[model samples]
Target: MRGHDLINTCLPDELIVEIFHHIESKSTRDACSLVCRRWRRLERLSRSFIRIGATDSPDLFVHLISSRFSNVTTVHIDERISVPLPLSELVKKPDKGASSSSALKLHYMKENNGSTSAEGDFDSLCLSDAGLSALANGYPKLQKLKLIWCSNVTSKGLTSLARKCVSLKALDLQGCYVGDPGMAAVGQCCKNLEDLNLRFCEGVSDKGLVELAVGVGKSLKSLGIAACAKVSNITMEAVGSHCGSLQTLSLDSEFIHNEGVNAVAKGCPNLKALKLQCINLTDDALEAVGVSCLSLELLALYSFQRFTDKGLCAIGNGCKKLKNLTLSDCFFLSDKGLEAIATGCKELTHLEVNGCHNIGTFGLVSVGKFCKHLSELALLYCQKIGDGGLLRVGKGCKFLQALHLVDCSSIGDEAMCAIARGCRNLKKLHIRRCYEIGNKGIIAVGEHCRSLTDLSIRFCDRVGDEALIAIGEGCSLQYLNVSGCHKVGDAGLIAIARGCPQLCYLDVSVLQNLGDMAMTELGEHCPLIREIVISHCRQITDVGLAHLVKSCTMLESCHMVYCSGITSAGVATVVSSCLNIKKVLVEKWKVTPRTKRRAGSVISYLCVDL
Candidate 1:
């Protein structure tokens, strides 16, 4: 409060706009709107969301976003939003055999700059049509609009943004090249659109989704149509006869079948979150999404090779408000359809079963004896689940907390000490390519998951150094991945740099006795290490990257690929001592040519020849 603090003449502009809405960091309300002019007119009237781009400057980016977010209600134009354009301004061609009168004068300069078509398709638009008619006449009460990968917005800039906003309600056109006359001019001018995402829009079909389900399908409610390959089943029977108040439907089609998922489970019976990818579905479209969406609750079934397990036992006996279920690569689902949806959905909670190979361990011991409000569980490549179905899903999911086991080769150490003595409120444990789990099953998940904080033991080659000194004396870690643990070295990197000093992401890549005194004991007991990926550690060198740039000062990124004893003077003392280093992947004999031009003048020094 020192710079002549007239704190808005001592508070009260409605308590400084309620203390700037508790300053939810948009760079701290842009450094309190540079501390003046009444905190820059109350932080531009509490910015209602603005991400205008397409390389800005269309009339000074809609006159600085209509003179500072004039009640802006969401807008995110893309193409990296800004700072892009220099590929010789994109239009390139004529470099073939000198002259035929300079190749018919470069084909009449590519037909007078309409560089090969559709009125020069916004020549790599960074938001065109006069920045969508100055963001539809300056955000005419704009209500959500996201045109990612801008791809030179079309349909005549979405028909002048649907004839000027008309109270739009959520419209996300990803990788936009707008078609079907921009979805029939956004379903005949927004009709109060209720969340519509047309991903990879391939000139929309079924005649622009039956003219956007006859104009905004009765005020649609969440509709995402992905990879449109001429959407069929007559656009799901015209979105099951005008969307009937659809409630979240994401269809990544393979020509959706089972009569287009039973006409969206009998025309959206108030559906609740459904994601179907590359469909050709069967099990009569999961038994018509189990008796017509009995209020479904998040269901994701990817690559349905003829959905089976009797359509997951008719969505576990008629979707009793099923709670989050994802079954990827559904190889004719087994474990008798996950033990009849864990004995008929006992309010299951987040479960992902990847590459399902006949759900084993008796359908995960009936999803640990009836879900018990299970919490996050991912069992990848379910190789006949082991340890007696993970000791009956760790003593029947005692409110489990994040557990992902990939390539479960009959997981060992008695299912990692029975999920570290029955989950004990576990906190993220990812064991990849489980080589029959070792190091006494990660010291029984570091003495019973003492509130673990993300631990990944990849390619667990007998995870060593006493499982990183019993996970640095019972966890305090913030992400530690022992990548391909070849008998972890430097006494397990100095016992996780003195037992995770609030460690921030460390992956000991191909650890073959990692050296340079374990990157100088992980920059002296991990001074908040910020991302260290030791790739193919052929005993890291340059005296352990000058003791990790003389003690990691929040080192941002350091990936040592094929570390042939890193050189170029230890990547020039980590691009002159960290200075919030942003990325340094070494190799190619640790890049030299004068430390690769002084590590490209501070950070981002790739070089890999590994």
Candidate 2:
């Protein structure tokens, strides 16, 4: 009855549809589908159609198309959930029109065969022939097709599909096994393509890219070809010559140089975002970007180790409307570059200076005073930043919404307090691997940051139960990670249960002090918990895990790595009690053995030593 009252009142059908447009997650909309018929109608019509996750059964699509008004325009299958290792092959042009799936098939690792790692019988990319035929027969309105890491999707099969789907706009072929021929077929077929991301498409050479530039030059708006190692001035020159109206271009890689930059400057007058990462771009390239691409708003120059304040100052003097800037790994930038940014760009909202250690707290203070509208700031690997710099940020940038100070080990709890007391609207805070912050900072955050939805203090050794209690009391936190924090135990877990009832994702793994009682508390309190990782927590025996399964209904992924106490019965109970359990993590290899309802899919976690 209480839950019924809390549900938002529905508006008119059109208004509800408009409201649903901004909701990014498909699962949330699926849940709302049960609310009312009007909501279902609105969910279908909502503009954003980003489908992501593990439950992408072929039947789901078949069901979706049969709906009254199916409007799933965009779908994104992220690797975080469903890591499809398909055996896909490109169909050559000869059999493209006649063959159903061509010779190309993306075959995912059929681990049902019991192959362990890549050491086992590696299956080729293969998609179901029936599914491919179904896709070709139906869904002609599909605009964007992202075959990311789908190595088996052959060019011939794509060509056939391309012929049927005339309205295709965007295509991402990143990490695919396709070559120049595949790109050529795409260029010939997908005429209305506006965005093309070919990152790590290693087979593509100067010729294929040139063909694409000539074919989709006028139409292509957003193009990302990051890490295509074979690229030279030939590709960029063609892009500059043909793709004149290009709005976004990512060339932040090793293979391209300033000649490409010069060509782009000469041709593409409307480029708004340009990424020239790792290119041999000296001050001359900056001059070109400054003088030619005046409409540019975002400019990321990673690996510009030789670049100094002069080059940045040139950009600042020229591109006054620039809003977002990333100079990660550019150690040459100092007070002069900082001053250039402070003086030139008043609309600056996002700034990242990772590895730029020369400029100290003073430069950041200047930034806080100037860039008041700044929403996202990342100082990853910036060693010079201290408590004073953070204090200055707290005082000046009251509207700062997100901050990431990962790997900056010098600052302590004082900085976190300052952030909590000052930046009240902070939505996301990630101080991962910052060893200095402790319980005091956690307490401050719990007391103040009323709207914090994401918090990660991973590797912050000094944090303990007090911090967890504070976070729990804060109530609104949805994601929390205290991984590698050894001091926290059941007290902290109790605090989390008492305070934050809306927690969906949690990682308290490697916290040696955390015991079975805390797990029981988490299970009881965080009923809405979707993902929980407690690997290496030796204290949490099967009894505690059992308690958790009994309490939390929606436990999807349970990671109990190195927690030898979790035996067959405990795992079986989770398999039974947590009906949605799709994956479980153990020691090394992920064993996706059958439980009851859903078969476990993936059980893998990796964090390379830094």
Please provide TM-scores, in order, for all candidate models, with all chains considered together. Answer: 0.38, 0.77
Residue lDDT tens for model 2, 1-610: 6656333464566777877776777678688877877677677677445443333233223323424345655545432354353221221233446533322221121322235556333332132223334454455777876665654455555666666666779888777656776566667777788998988887778888888788888888999987787778899999999998899988757767778888987799898998878647788788888888888899998878757888888888888888999877787788778878867887788988888878777778778778777888898887787888788778878888899988887778898899889999999988888888888988898889888889888888888888878777874778988899888888988888767889899998898888888888888888999999988888889899998889798888888878767766676677678777777766433333554234445444353221
| Model 1 C-alpha lDDT per residue in residues 1-610, reported as the tens digit of each score | 6756676567877778778778878888888888777778877877778875554233334444665667778887766644445332432454666545445434533443344455544453455565676678878888998888666667887878887897999989887767787788888888999998888887778887789788989998888888888877888878888888899988898876778779878998998999988657688877988998899999998877876798889999999888899999888888989898888988989999998887788888888888888888999988888889878888888778888999889879887788789888889888887898899988888888888888888887878999889989888888899888898899877887888888888898888787888778778888888888887888888887787778777787888766777767777787778788867876566566776675563444356444
| Error in Å for residue 57 of model 1 | 18
Model 2 ranges off by over 4 Å: 1-124, 127-142, 150-166, 177-190, 588-610
- How many pairs of residues collide in each model? 0, 31
Error of 2 at 41 (Å): 17
What overall lDDT goes with each candidate model? 0.80, 0.74
Q: How close to the true structure is residue 420 of candidate 1, measured as C-alpha lDDT?
A: 87
Best-matching candidate per lDDT: 1
lDDT at position 242, candidate 2: 92
